[model samples]
Target: PRVTAFSKQLEKFHVIIDSELAVKMLRDAPSPGKNWSAFLKVDCGNNRAGVWWKDEAGVDLAVLLQNSPNIDFAGVYVHCGNSYHTSSSEEVIQVLDDTIERLMTFVNHVRQRGVTCSTVGIGSTPTCRKPTDRMKSLTELHPGNYAFLDVQQWSLGSCTEEDIACCVATRVIGHYPRRNQMLIDCGFTGLTKQGYGEMASGYGVIRGHPNLKLCKMTQEIGFVESLEGKLDYSLFPVNSLLYILPWHSCATAAMHSVYYVVEGDTVVEEWRPTRGW
Candidate 1:
């Protein structure tokens, strides 16, 4: 296990523990010369991961982590991913409030049992972007995708179109006047087909082209058509570049190995994202 092999190197890092089996794995792991610091991931509302907040087994796991000599129970961590399903900032705030309430209640229950949790946190770009007064009680807020917001975030009212910091720049490869469609170099592999029905503009929002819609995509080709009437080939000639604001920036970014940091028509730097889980 990486934790067992590189315990010293990861002494400062906190691992999230959700189930009793995971706790057992950490306890059974070869002694890393130091106790593993961990946070109990609680499922406040987002049912994706973590132990259910109201489940007694969740509390038992917390207690087990606290009592284990091989592990140190740091606190609680929650991801309010359900907030992303909402359509407005108000709905996001409601999810935020409910998550905080549930998290605090669980923390209180843990505290009643003499388990001291030093950290209480919740995260999700939508909930974090639309903060409520109740969020003040949390010790930490982790909004990971706020760095490169996308159309999904905009649809959830987490941010504005201008706040989307990244896009896929594709070139026109072919023009189909008869079918009223144009082919682009970037497809599902490049931009990802994430926002299917979520956006009116289709897969992604074509920057500066309100009338254009990305109707379909193959592995390496995207079909773009006009939303209004006829396809204008003269406006977008072959080999011309078009920037598309992806629906999910995280998925789109994973398709590329390197990112060019641009500044006012000039590429000032290059960033290579770390690969692997």
Candidate 2:
């Protein structure tokens, strides 16, 4: 909708374009009567998208975006999405700080081009936890999803375990004679696997069972493995419901068509479904 609003105003006030194709579209755009700002995207350390910041001509794309009569150069932006793929907060901080330093240098180079700049921006959840003032000099910090954090964010120091707001509820289908094992009805079908490989075991975390872990899963079968020693049969029994915390709640929740809202022991309502972009 922001893009659409800017498009409608393409003929009136100033605006900024975030994508390269957007830069080009606005660049070759017919006379809009007003100038629009478009920044080049550069990948400093993140290999995902955007121009390589290390490239000598990285900021040169900004120059191209400026070449158009209707398009003004806003500055470059990059996102360290790759930073979320780490285990420790210390490691996440290292990548975020390094990327910011590299991006600032690139922004400076754009200024050296003698073009009047408007803004510069970049983002990530782990990066958001770092002091924003250091990058406030940037045009904007557009980090989304911090509001709906998950286990990955918790482990990365972006948030605490208490910050995760989504979870899964499954019932113990069959108790294993092997002590700790259980055949849960939930499997890849219920909770899609999206955990970072950093975890010691399975794709999901068991909520209250500190010693019990989701060992593995099949189409509709789950193997509960004991954290240590042998599994005792006294604690959990067949038909006992378990709330499984996801490694990444958003991704796992996306698998289910609907979410049942359970209060205490009874589900009173169901949440609506969501669509992907």
Candidate 3:
């Protein structure tokens, strides 16, 4: 419906097909605008979606989609999401290279069969960031998390702390001097329940306070714990403001409707984001 609503301005939109049935459905579906194409999603290694790379069915589906007159074959795309599972940059690059090699071989096979495959889209933040050189065959890189680097991205060596852009600003609501812990107004509702990769003890790090971490939380309250047990409790009194770097910026940002865009300490603008499907 949204596509039809804006059909006047939409020149082309490509839908990803994971199976032969999806390709058939896309081919049969009425065009929403002037040009609509289909992208065959091949699972190079991710195992998340798309037809498996070694599976002959995938090639058959691609050939079918390419020959279909109603839907143009926009080529194949693979999202190597498992790239984040690697422990180091070398491993990430290896996964990306392997994925790309498989994708290239598949495209080559399709071309050998007299099919005109043009675009080969590949992306995953860790894979894209770690690759020493770009794959010449890949037409597009669609790394989503690169825009707002999260703790996971930093842990995966995909980005650094300086590259992180989003954070949660919370105020101290309660203090536990005896346990060296304090309660902040931010919780799962605001900061989200996501945790940093391999850093099991805390959910997120407090900006500028390397030893302080948001360890636990309820619906509306976050427990700030001092990692070293040497934190001066006097500094964080009631109503004191603190900024929390989110473990996963995408999930955390989804909790808010409008972004409070700030420049230095002043609110410069308000940006509202799209919501719902």
Evaluated with lDDT, which candidate comes out highest? 1
lDDT of 3 by residue, 30-147 (tens): 6665545788888988999988888888888888987876688888899999997889998998998899889988888888888888889997888888755657768889888877
Clashing pairs in 3: none
Clashing pairs in 2: none
Could you tell me which 10 consecutive residues in candidate 2 have the lowest summed lDDT?
10-19
lDDT per residue for candidate 1 within 159-235, as digits (tens), equals 78999999889999999988999999998989888989977899999999999999999999999999999988999
- Which lDDT tens digits does candidate 2 get at residues 32-144? 45566465677987787787777766666676676766666666678888787777777877777788888888778877886666667777878877654466567777676
Query: What's the TM for model 2?
Result: 0.74
Q: What stretches of model 1 exceed 4 Å from their correct place?
A: none
CA error at residue 162 for candidate 2, angstroms: 1.8
Instruction: Indicate the residue-level lDDT of 186 in model 2.
Output: 81
TM-score of 3: 0.91
Could you say which candidate leads in TM-score?
A: 1
For every model shown, what is its TM-score relative to the native structure?
A: 0.95, 0.74, 0.91
Count of residue pairs whose backbone atoms collide, per candidate: 0, 0, 0
Q: Is candidate 1 or candidate 2 better by TM-score?
A: 1
